[model samples]
Target: MFDIPQLDLKGKVSDAEWQTRVDLAACYRLVAMHGWDDLIYTHISARIPDSEHLLINAFGLAFDEITASNLVKIDFQGNIIDENCPFEINPAGFTIHSAIHEVRHDAMCVLHLHTNETIAVASLEQGLLPLSQYAMFALASMSYHEYEGLAVNPAEKLRLQQDLGMKNFMLLRNHGGLTVGKTIGDAFMHMYDLTRACQIQLQIQGSGQPAVLVDQEIVDGIRAQANIVHTGLTGGQKSWPAMLRKVYRTDPHFAR
Candidate 1:
């Protein structure tokens, strides 16, 4: 469907980088499968292990079209590291991911999407109410960033970092949602909880009925409870394999 050239990096790159590429590619496919992709707009980025360079989608390819080797590698300044890569990344798209990646060393993967439900919830003054169990997980470590037109300015990076602080989830007011995790799976899981919370919130509001919010105590303690439930195996680590399986069943070429 697309005229993008294919490059095989399986043997060309280190085993660790190859794994990151495959996982990031699978993450893109999963986002598309969930109908959360905004064409080629939003980005999901992964830091190259033990390196300053990161991997992101080659700008023009749709989520489903992304393959492991086709992912673009770049430095913190958004310069494409591979001269042979026939794709140019969207500078504006990288602005948000780059900002977060710069300050959050623990954030190995950063996922951002512009789903309608997230935009609606973020636009509200209340912002991500603890109305569902999903919301509780999100509210446990959520932050909000006021939309500042397009996030193209380098100056905006500092403010975004400051607003995000140590939070894993961020609702970009009137914009979209962003999640950062120590791994690609963790980032995807965070997005899942956040997107579902917004979807449920919209459904309840649209019904025009009074909504029941979760207790503040429960919301406050959700992290500890989640830790126990996911004990030796975190939610993402457990669920990611299933996610990979589903994606593979759909089309295994994402790993390329």
Candidate 2:
């Protein structure tokens, strides 16, 4: 039931664009592997290198069903850019992703997901507390955007861009979570940290025990500490290769 025709874009597009497609498709499969996908609802989008065109999954396909060649390419205005690409993108996905891409040139990939943990945390008044080491990574660069319905309104684009200004991690109030990165792996890792933070928070809350919050001093210095921990490897460059290997081991067809 998940069979999707391969467009065999290996040679049809620029080498960089093709690589972006493969990585973006890997991101989707990784999300699925982690049980983070909300069916075909949330989106993970990547910018084609040196181009305004963006890549997103076709609206009707589930995350596990996504493949490199099946992803639809579209412009800022949500117009399909791939010739005879028999697929359409989600308008809400375009609205959220395009708003961020238009303003944050550094954000080559924008990953959004509707995981229950994130939604629950975002709905709370506190919104992602400093309860765990995972939370510190997100808190170091977090932003929150109050939910405004379904995010399809063009008028909300400016507001989203403003709310997410220069922040890599975002919690959409009453909705889900979003992360931006200089590459697909960076975006995936950001979401990974955020999701874990939310998951830990909910577990503590459910336990009915007092949560030990991370010290403000440590939280404030997390960015520098993260650099030290990663040892100058920024933007998930250090971890992405391992992530790609895991995805490839699971299914190599995502690169098609």
Best by TM-score: 1
Residues 91-189 of candidate 2 have per-residue lDDT tens digits of 999999999999999999999999999999999999999999999999999999998999899999999999999999999999999999998999999
TM-score of each: 0.98, 0.97
| Cα-lDDT of candidate 1 | 0.93
Candidate 1 wrongly placed segments (more than 4 Å): none
1-256 per-residue lDDT for model 1 (tens digits): 5467978888899999999999999999999999999987999999999999999999889999999999999999999999888999988778988999999999999999999999999999999998999999899999999999998999999999999999999999999999999899999999999999999999999999998878898899999999899886667898999999999999999998
Error of 1 at 213 (Å): 1.5
Find the number of clashing residue pairs for candidate 2.
Answer: 0
